[model samples]
Target: MTSTPSANLFKPLEAGDPAVVGGYRLAAVLGTGGMGKVYLTYTPGGRPIALKVIRPEFSEDLEFRRRFQREVQSAQRVQGLYTAPVIDSDTEGSQPWLATAYVPGPSLGHAVAQHGALPLRSVLLLSVGVAEALHVIHGAGIVHRDLKPANVLLASDGPRVIDFGIARAADTTALTGTGVSVGTPSFMAPEQASAGTVSPATDIFALGQIAAYAAIGSPAYGEGSSHAVLYRIVHEDPDLSRVPAELLPLVTRCLTRDPAGRPSLTEIIELCHEISPVPLRQGEDWLPQAVAGSITERLRLPEPAKTPPPLPTVAPTPTQYAPQQPQTPPPTQFSPQHPAPGGVNPYAPTGFSQAAAPTQSAPGIPGPVPPPGHPMQPTPPPGYATRPTPQPGYHTPPPVVHAPYTGPQQPKKKRTGLIVAASVVGAIVVLGVIGSLLPDGSGKDDESKSPSGGGSSASSTGGGSGDGEASGTDAGKKRPDPKPASYQGIDVTENYLVMLAGDPPRPEEGDPIYGGGDLSYYVDSMFGDTWIGTDNGKFILLNNSQKGSLETCRTETRYTEKITLDQLSAGTEFCVLSDAGHIAVATYKGKGGAKESTYVTFDLTVWRNAEEAKEED
Candidate 1:
């Protein structure tokens, strides 16, 4: 068979280069690496995708090809909003490649290198986005294995995880090559450095280092050679002083040396929200779009009617697969000439059939009964079967297997007979050794055990009760009863609630409370909605939509006397009114000591209108 043309291999057809291998028309070179080159490619249609072609030398290695196939399967398992979905793959082709949805943006590393440190807002967004990705990846039982700045992209909409070529499943058979390590050294965990093992915690540690790098524009362990960085990861604590104080607790949790101690991805997402300006919402419309004109320019090509056919399957080589199980051992038979002594015998006749005899009983349970064909043989009369005579420094032979025989079985046998026998032997040995160490109690007098003052048992019990009562009385005198109804200065109305600085306010359940923060911050709402104050002093506005889903709005405003609901303005810009009649806004006012109010306005008309609409539908 003749080999394919070299010029046609992974060459772009759209750039005045001839179409190569199988009708694929590569548009632009995306990136090149030691293993392969990634190219921006398109079908006959205008749809664009990123295609990676494996290097020729790497393709020759069957083991590498198998791993690549497994990677494709693992990558395909990731299904979430933040992950770039895997579209197709050609694992068996001359140059195996996988295609994923083309995400438009600079790699995080490139973004940081060009733009310097990201602002706090962007970092928060990145943290939440990446955490979401890891959550999905981990849920699928796979580790990204190489989570680094280069593998993370700052896309227009949000952060996206890319390059899962080396991802491994928790239960997968793939093993790291001896003396070989994967992942960038700067971000690897100590366990990863020592080639110990990788797990979800490994990703958490890596994320902590990444967060530290993002915060300070430097690695948490500082700049150094690969070896030095690896050493620090294995032996040193990460420097997290530059991390924002608010986020320090979360970062510390993630940087724990023990994998079991790391906080989960969900916890990291919550931490990001704690420091973010935008409260996480399900349908927030702030998703950034791809950079203007970038996707269109990159995907320039005629749209094909359909995706290319999958490549033919290749038979895996012998060395590429793991050995099958159920390994069988050589069979051996019992030797009758073996000697038995001291009630101990390795070849003792266990009450089991020949077929089941080889299998040992579970650690503590007795062996199963022998099959009907294999009955227990009677024990030989004492001295009939000669016990081996002891020889100086000579090892004795093992016990012989007895022939099967039918006989009356022993009923009601005690399960702990062996244990009792061993215990009795141990007790006799202990008593002989300790018999002289303790004094005899024969001289003790029964009268000496009586109370010094002669008294009946009933009298003694009565005295104890009196003493107990006296101690209880003294303890009660030392501590006063707590005051009832601690909150005295707050007020609650049907529509709102107010908390005074002097005392915390208490509201009965179902009461619409407001006024922890800027109560005057006006937000437009659908008709028939209500707002309530939360224990955190923020207001939660609820729209009584038919669906019964509540839209929550958190405000930064603090409750103060100076602010009022009437002073706030209503407009489309500062409010979000759901079709079911819910609206909310976040507002804050005044510095320290200044009382701020969060004003929430409910529109009964909008809710009524939504109800009418639903009725019409």
Candidate 2:
């Protein structure tokens, strides 16, 4: 069966969001709230359901998952006419989600806002239905921790309680984890507002708040800030002026300050039945005509589109490794490896003849030509200077800046005492190299490119034999320290660190005091996750995330211009932002004048003139 439309609450799927969860086809988004997003979907058996996918941040939290899983188990046991039962779930996936029978109705909060206070008769039915659902939920050992107007659905038959996403076992201590409280403070129970232990009575207190809202189209406690509403809930009595006199007794009892003083759901239900104009039943029409008609329209609304198809997985040529048999030599020990004279990785893997290399390469990616006809050996990609080749005893070095690319190059290191004379090709036999290089699929352009100004004189000698002989003594030497050009006296870190731009292009040995670069390098690099600022001489990392706009380098990063990286070292503490997906550092001279500050502004203007390109290829 097709799912229903979300009444303007549905949003089109975004990039990176999944089209299917487990097996259900997600058609349209129902809504998005605090925990994650809810989608309109259907089971294979044609059962319509609302599926909620946990957000990335919440999925990554181990503690939250535990509580969610436990709460889901309890929610499944809740069976009530006023509650949407949990039908399916996957709490162990990379991102968790739960599916429940669809309740195609607007929230009580929405209904009240759109059509004013529900009639006293409807409110009485709403009160009775929710109280009964709570009875079932509490009996199943679950407490609806975040019960507010938004969580209460105004179904034609009665009100349905939903969004048990944060519900937890009534008996569990420290509901989720330390230092985290989840609930809408405006409608939260007094104990919850004070961060006290939550129980079934806690839900009862919140129920009273929702009932109050449904009666007056506003909160019973004065509508101000959250703190104000919560203060009134705890310290003062609710303003019963707007509430019809009939609901005052039941509402007041539920809003009692003491959890023990509040009447049980059974007691509230009996009182509601006494006052309800019509007998409450499973199919009772408790909602007014306008409100019930809205629900009817929602259920009949057609889903505008079909579920999207799954995205295709395209495999790039370079990362395809050909299978091979293990080579058996004199079982020689492995030794340290070095790059060829021009800083080329002799062991770079070549792509299969069937696939041609793409012209646009990621940073540090090298195009290696295979030898005439020898067995394959492990080869590093063009721009990847830090991935350790799976060969024993030899250490891989950084990518080289060289001219005149040549045939498949072998690693510059060797086994201490093993040299096979197996069938050979052009002047040499390929060693234990594998077929194809499997670089990460991310579009990293680390190919060896010379910095704009001029090549720096700074260079280090890689330790290895001048001839093709394997020297175990020199092989064990640590690969020449990572390029010390990013920071003074320290090697540039692999993976996390990337030097966006700086005064010298490379770092100095003593300190970065006088060495700095244009602040606009951040704009040039388009690495929107970090921000760097300099005051006097010492450079500090700024909180990029708080920078207000994502176009700025400091959009989502923790370090802000106000914070200093004085306590952090480049490699050990933070790394450069390279194709290897590591930390990166950008530096420039003290406030480098206005020339560097306006870097991003200049780049945006270049976009219009892109039609005036030098080469199309």
Candidate 3:
């Protein structure tokens, strides 16, 4: 198992390592921890896999075996980036073992240790991806008890939370031994250190620590002996002075000793997204220069063959070893310092450590190599987020599972990468009013009463098709022109679209239109795909507000009541409010309540330019 496979992160297997596990040939060592040893292996099809063989002590225990089986089953259900998904397992065997998708990226600890504090933007993107992964992980009912930086793999896609060895289903019993704490001291939550009930919040606390470490290049709690660090985590306030100011509040909130006081994963995503929502595009480098170089070194291994012998199952063998999904690496180079189009350099240059890392150059790496004379002020190759510069050295998506929200999901027919601008964060924001977009900023006074704040109203959130609220977008023959067009009080262009939150209601009145309704929009787009954005509350417009008068429309105004669409969030009902204060549950016509925008799956209801949009009945 010492053939030097996998990217730079994996090493030659030791003498004690097994040559094969469950029919998959072990190639090298990925990592080792107190829980078990992780080896790099490949499926019969040549797809890389990380095989973790549990120690005899843990596997021999009947209770541990059952727990491992259940945990692995639970881990298999988890498909998001928070933790690598389980590909296969053999808990019933003498020594329980599990295999997962292999990520050719460095751990956060190694990246930070080699390069110093990560750039502010990288930290923000890291937060978004990790938080979203946590959201999905929790949704799967699994709590990753061990979520330290070492457990976080920096893939070409984004940060991937891995190593579910210590993870347990929230409904399971604690696996505590006599005075045993099953976690890294510096990153453990106070409750975990004190042997209290471990919950999702424990992971939140560790996330704060990860953030602090990535930002400060050291533990948030001053480092010392294991006991001292554990004590500090349990008793002392974290030293966040070194943390960046923009991230201070959220980071502080995550570190709150009281689990109840800490912000929920939802809040953390919202807040961190407000600071930096979009992360690196697939194949876009997010690690420091030295670390990216290491990743390149690792990717030198050839991809797992299309079809390898299947894991020992009573059933037939798989023709291809790779995951069913197509993970073609982008034709780009590796230059974390400069991102290609549709991308950005998430790494910050603050306190950049220049220590020479042990890692070597990857084959055909898209990295920034210094020129003959001048310093390495290299321009990154065009990536998905930006225009595609199909050059050498660019990272492709490895088999490793990444944060749920991470990865490059391009818009239909567009190959561009995505870049979620940091400047946009507010979940709901009102761009400048467009006189033409809204029939009239000041609607007919008699018909327009402030929007109804009453109980019976409708709102459109993330994903929904019910009650004809906001239907999906129809890629009708109509394509938004790049030229700015005034549509419904927003400046519209091919690059950005303007969306509105229906008019508000006046006091004591139910919604005059459709009783009462709320409006929200979300633009999940890739590069060259126009997106209706929100940087938290950065860009906002009050409901029923006047053309230039913020005082005019004073009905039901609440920016927090907004929803971006997603497939799982369908059936949520919402009314579309108009400037005239008319509420609409759905833009349906007949008794069946047929809907428009049947093909659309985002928050776009109206077009600012009348020429392009034909409002159909």
lDDT per residue as tens, model 2, 1-617: 23554547656677756655554556677777767788876654444578887776666555557777888878887878889988777776667777888887889888888899988878887888888888888888777888988889877777889866364421122222222334677777777654455789998888887878888888877677765666676667878788878888888988898999999888998988787666766454667788887776567534533433332233335533343343332321110121112222112221111122323345665344223232343333232344433343232223447988798898889654444433344224233233223434543322312232132211112332122223333455443322222333222211111123332333222211111211212221132222232211122243433221112321334432212323333222211221111123332222122432321111000001111211111
Candidate 2 global TM-score: 0.48
State the lDDT at 115 in candidate 1: 53
In candidate 1, what are the lDDT values of residues 1-617, reduced to their tens digit?
A: 12221232224344422233223444556666545567765533344567666655555555566777787788788988878877656666555666667776666676566556666666677777888888888887677777888778666677788765454421121122122233577888877764456788898998887777766677788767876787688778988877878668767887898889898888888888877766854322223233223323333333322433333233323321232243332321111121112111212221111121222235554333222222332232221343444463343223448979879878986779898999999999999889854545763333333565344332333433322222321443422221222222132333343222112323332312122221222221322222332321223322233121212232322232222333433321122222122222322221111123223323211111111110001
Q: In model 2, where is the ten-residue run with the lowest total lDDT?
A: 601-610
Instruction: Determine the C-alpha RMSD for candidate 3 after optimal superposition of all C-alphas.
Output: 26.3
Measured against the true structure, the TM-scores of the candidates, in listed sequence, are 0.43, 0.48, 0.47
| C-alpha positional error of residue 258 in candidate 3 after TM-score superposition, expressed in Å | 0.9
lDDT of each: 0.50, 0.54, 0.54
The regions of model 1 sitting more than 4 angstroms off are 1-22, 165-182, 281-617
Residue-level lDDT tens digits of model 3 in 463-551: 22223333123223233222211122222222122223322211222211112112323222221111122211111232222231212
